[model samples]
Target: MKNPLILLALAATLSATAADAAEVPLYETGPAEDSSFVRFVNGGQQPLEIVATGSNARLTLDTAKPASDFLPIRAGKPIEGALVRGGAKRNVSVTVQPGEFASVVGLDDAAGGLRTVVVHEQPDDFNALKASVAFYNLDAQCASAALLAAGRNIVLLDQVPEGQSKRRQINPVPLSVQLSCAGQAVGQPLDLGTLEAGQRYTVFLVPAGKQSRIFQATDTVAR
Candidate 1:
């Protein structure tokens, strides 16, 4: 009869190989221009090694890390990209139109792997006296929410759906921001002393201990 120990060892080797395939990195390449920008966000449970190929850029991001600012890259046609982790590799394909603002996010897949999506940001006329902000709903548990500017009747965003982002313009003044869901407040309002005019910001809502929370980052937009 075949040795049981040998069979067990073979099974272990095959299992390890399957695991590696499940975590392989994704890669791709595309044309791009300087008028465009690329922002990165990590929403997956496992950390990742972010590599922007054909552009010479890389970043290491952990779970729920704040969105990266619009990063400038040398305009290149057929630019390559890759997301690597656990010694596995996968190729990513991306294309940015001229004057386009975009963000790429890493998310968790249903199978405990990684899923990536590219978000095209909307552009608006600059308000020299106000600041613009964008909100992205990435929390799997938070279906929707609203953004209220303190003392203002403005609803910056209403029913922002999950896995998407919304933008609004706010006055460059001291104010607090609050979030509400299902007709009730989730947490304390954030006191933003004042926002700088002509600057852009992006906020991400993430899961935190049975509740959803937020983190903000500045974005560099070309005039």
Candidate 2:
């Protein structure tokens, strides 16, 4: 009923249109506008559970896995929740600014109660040619903490006070480091094998009896 040459031309036009549409990029769904990021870290001796209010998100952390992936939350609003340990619950709240990143650390108080500390992460200018490392000092007995290259006298991070953190950018390479607190070595050397460029890392010095224990984790965001 239609001209054969006209039909072929129409088909080619439709195919080109479909191909152009497919080439258009599709982006992932991101966090809400003005949202901040927050993560949980268990600096205590026991397993910790975070039950968020009005949300179904539940995060658990223990000595073996002491950190959680970052989650998006409304900025400038207090996040009300409970920290549960061994069936015991303690109410906790944390707040952060818009576009900020924070870590909520659960610790054992001197009075034998569950407590929390919010550590705001300092903004950094990312370097694509280097690796970023952050050190968190959660050991109360350690007035100051330091991270040094194992078998070498070089210190990567030094004089980090208790309840705080410090970050630095370094060359990407296979490396090992030792944790020291109060001028004494705290634990066995930590082997951080073959760091890649543009990656981020975090090391924590958590309290363990009279001494301290060290662990490392790669920073990640919750999808």
Candidate 3:
């Protein structure tokens, strides 16, 4: 027969090991399936920074790079943050439905302060054989923004109003584009390198010093 104290000690060790196993998680938790996505765009002349609540992540936007990649957040919950430009700070919030994508843009307010505009859209769906392009008119001075093929009258996107965006599918090809606002060209032509099939692109018409400039970025999703 086994010694009683020895068996008791062995049993106690087994129990403690079982308890530790129970405390350990089998897998790490990830974002929920119904989570939404959000990104930041700086439409104003000055560079902007965003510090979201409950997160240490910081998103910065400037003239060279006007948009940030999307980040996932809980659906229907407002993602509140502080928008910082130089020494000034202002509160901002954005909300979106489950499975939706949103862009929170910082624009120049009438008082020369910073204001925000939220643009929402469903997850992108497009033909696999073609590329997708979107145009966002965030320049308040541009009442109607139009995108055209450079050196040609070919209009890709036309008559987009301020704070609005439009998307279309196009055959994969190299192209140069120009921005015209309210029937007048705002900036010089921009060369969009060869577009690839199944890829996404976005062009933004943002405000500059008393004029407007165009920015381009490839759209991507977080894994």
Candidate 4:
């Protein structure tokens, strides 16, 4: 009873709409209202794909490279997404405030599982004459840890709780990072090379079987 011409036109319209939808990207540019940045870090062994949806949303992040531009998500709104690794996935979420710098770290659980930890990055107000350093605890096996600057006889951070981070501004120095648990050293101290002025850095304490080790990455924060 339906006219053949009418049916063909309807089919054509539907096809064109679907094609247009596909051309649109899943993550669009955030509005000017968004004033903060959230970076994603994949600390797990497998590569990860990160996504977030909310005000001033961010398109997906590929592999291990952090979002070149910090996610322009609205402050205080919940940004939720999933982390896909090797065909398997896990959910992750976080809320950030205006002018705040935050990150989501992908970590491995004790039972061979995977999870995410949301960390509020310490703000850096240092000028070109100084530098900043922050330490993150990702070693699930280690309950707590500390960072000592070798030969300086100084403790940069003490009693850093698991899944948390602490940061401080310091003069340019050659730092030997050490991790301790239950007041005992986890392993040999790690030479963090040299920290230069006007740069922001993060040290990640990661698990190595019964003990743990340290890895570092430079943040893209402008001084």
Candidate 5:
């Protein structure tokens, strides 16, 4: 009952809509990133739409308006007692194949409250991982830096250009590294309780009596 010209036009519109739907967005399979807003990181290969509520969130590649569509579950928000936004959840995700996994991070008002959380929904392989909240001061300047031990790895995260000190730091402490050496440490770790605005300390990762072991400082941030 439609005119020929109108029928052709309708077909083209439908085709374009379908193409847009097929082109997955960059949100999928990328580490969680937030310019100023907090969002969940999506880990699936296909881009997903995020649904967030007061205390619940989920990600799916289904692209359906509602949950009753054909979206596969890639990740999920924490329940009541997990390690994220105070065991809540964070916005950090990476693109993951069906059997692979990735993590996301959440930032707080204070650098001392930054936490990282890993999400796995019906994971194909490994389970989820979570690290306690590690605090950093943006106001302090980095002096010298070093690794904790022979086998431990340290992650010096990006700086917080917009913090109280106008400079912030995020770093990781590997548990595998022993916390001390012959009464001296490679550093004095960030001790939040005793620190002022521009003070700095180091944490020493003493070797476990292993000699001739070389230490590798991969991602260390020094000011």
Candidate 6:
């Protein structure tokens, strides 16, 4: 739950009664770089992610440049606090609700080209990515990324079916599964020989590596 330092310009807040005027910061969402509210994907599990719907998902800030290029916000519970950066009394406010916009306080060109737009630093919780490695068991079956080295593998599944004369005898149940590990085939499937009665062969999964081998399900017996 890191705080967003660039969004909240710590503007001195005096009661409206004490001051005749209070300035509310302002900005636009027109520029390609400043497409209004910056969009982000919550790759990690964050509660705030529940609200960001479309291209408007954002964490407002006072930095002059896109927060992704400078600093970024991590996905988490909605942040209401602010950060003080570059000698500015900054106070940042944010919400998941869409259609409304907030002005980045410290980013006024009058002082200088403080390229601040309404974006916070990238949130550690989310990523601009689509997929990640998922785990599975690879007993004599195909191993997935979970078992594949460097996220890939050259797994082989070879079987020796009985001759047609024996194939016509009993059932078509598989006796055992085999696996080729490294450069060697570690084991072989038990020979079902001639299928006997209602006997069924059960299969089990063994790990090739902690994160090796992807598991794929098959219904060959039914086939």
**How many steric overlaps are in each model, in order?**
11, 0, 0, 0, 17, 35
Candidates 2 and 3 compared: the better one by TM-score is: 2
Candidate 1 lDDT, 1-223, residue by residue in tens: 2111100111121011111112111110122334555656665546776665444345666744444445433322333467766655556766656666667776655555666767776464456666778877766676557777645646677676777788877877776777766656667776756677766677767665467776666664211
lDDT of all predictions: 0.57, 0.69, 0.68, 0.59, 0.24, 0.23
Worst 10 residues of 5 by lDDT: 2-11
What C-alpha lDDT, on a 0 to 100 scale, does residue 191 get in candidate 4?
77
Off by over 4 Å in 4: 1-34, 51-69, 122-124, 151-153, 221-223
- What is the alpha-carbon lDDT for the whole of candidate 6? 0.23
From the highest lDDT down, the ranking of the candidates is: 2, 3, 4, 1, 5, 6
The lDDT, on a scale of 0 to 1, for candidate 1 is: 0.57
Candidate 1: where are CA atoms >4 Å away? 1-34, 44-47, 54-57, 62-65, 73-78, 84-90, 109-112, 150-154, 191-193, 207-211, 221-223
By TM-score, who's the top model here? 2
Kindly list the per-residue Cα lDDT of model 3 for residues 1-223, writing each as its tens digit.
Answer: 2111100111121011111112211011322458666767787768998775554546567877676655556677666777778776777767778877788878776667777777876634556677778888877777667998888968999777777788888899998889887777777999889987777788888777678888787665433
In Å, residue 54's CA in model 1 sits off its true spot by 6.2
Worst 10 residues of 6 by lDDT: 160-169
Order the candidates by TM-score, highest first.
2, 3, 4, 1, 5, 6
lDDT tens per residue, model 5, 101-193: 222323232343434333322121111122222112211122222223324344332232212111122233333332222323433343323
Residue-wise lDDT of candidate 2 within 1-223, one digit each (tens)?
Answer: 2111100111121011111112211012222347676777887779998776655446667877777656556677776777777756777777768767788777776666777777887455467678778888877777668999888968999877777788888899998989877677867899988877777788888766667788887665554
